[model samples]
Target: MNDDLHLRIILISPPADVDFGLQSGSGNKYKTVQKQVSGNGDLLFVLSVKIKNDKDGNIDFAGPFVQGSKGERFIYIDIGTYAGNPESEWGRRLKIPLRDIPVSVIEKLQPDNKLILETRVPGMGKDGGPNCATVKPFEGWHAVPV
Candidate 1:
């Protein structure tokens, strides 16, 4: 069994031609490509992460992963300003914390298991301000067999 965690992070109907990526707590990053979504939109990314555990038995990862203190462990996602250029002044960074996740879901996490995280990027353009991009979980998080 592959102990590494498989993450399927999907962005539904993001702003056209914008860039997106996955960022770790160590500052490493992976840029996402615009892939065709079934609904005439784009899917941001589906990344694989190596699972690590802290001394306190909390879940952690090796690279480009961030887990908060005992109360707020999370995964970080970055939204770039443009499709090709990730360094735009208008880019945004979002987080998906592990809080509120059911214990049953965590218990189901085994080697090679896949976790699906779907979110929608809201208020991209328009009067939405510089920090306008707010990420909300679209369908919540799911853990499934690989």
Candidate 2:
């Protein structure tokens, strides 16, 4: 395994919007959803990264590995922190700061090897109002030819 293989984990933050839902009455009355906003909140996201083995021979990919029912394959990653916004709105869109993630591989893979990555962000709520939304990376992983 090389030093680059050790750098295979990355954390990134994307853009997000505030979602507002209105409660309507039968007599043309409506209610607005009230929620508390703060600037000291953090956004977290999880990523799943998989390195596929296609070519012949032995290859060691440097990254976290989770055991599965089928076999000892690679998939999904657990990233602790990322980037997010701190704007408050009833229902609006806002651009927030994002985090940077970098991944390195120590070992080399065979030919036709593929890598897949997925990102997931948990939802948060405040003051019994709607949960805060978060934006994450579109794709989690990348593939490299060894």
Q: lDDT scores for all predictions?
A: 0.49, 0.28
Residue-level lDDT tens digits of model 1 in 15-126: 5544555564433334434323123374555665555556776655443454455555566555555223536544565565545545466557655454443334432434
Whole-model alpha-carbon lDDT for candidate 1: 0.49
Model 1 scores a TM of: 0.57
Worst 10 residues of 2 by lDDT: 76-85
Poorly placed runs, candidate 1 (over 4 Å): 1-3, 26-40, 49-63, 81-89, 111-134, 137-139
Off by over 4 Å in 2: 1-98, 105-114, 133-146
- Best candidate (score: lDDT): 1
lDDT of 2: 0.28
What lDDT tens digits, residue by residue, belong to model 2 across residues 40-91? 3433323222433335523323233222222333323211111112344333
Cα displacement (Å) at residue 11, model 2: 16
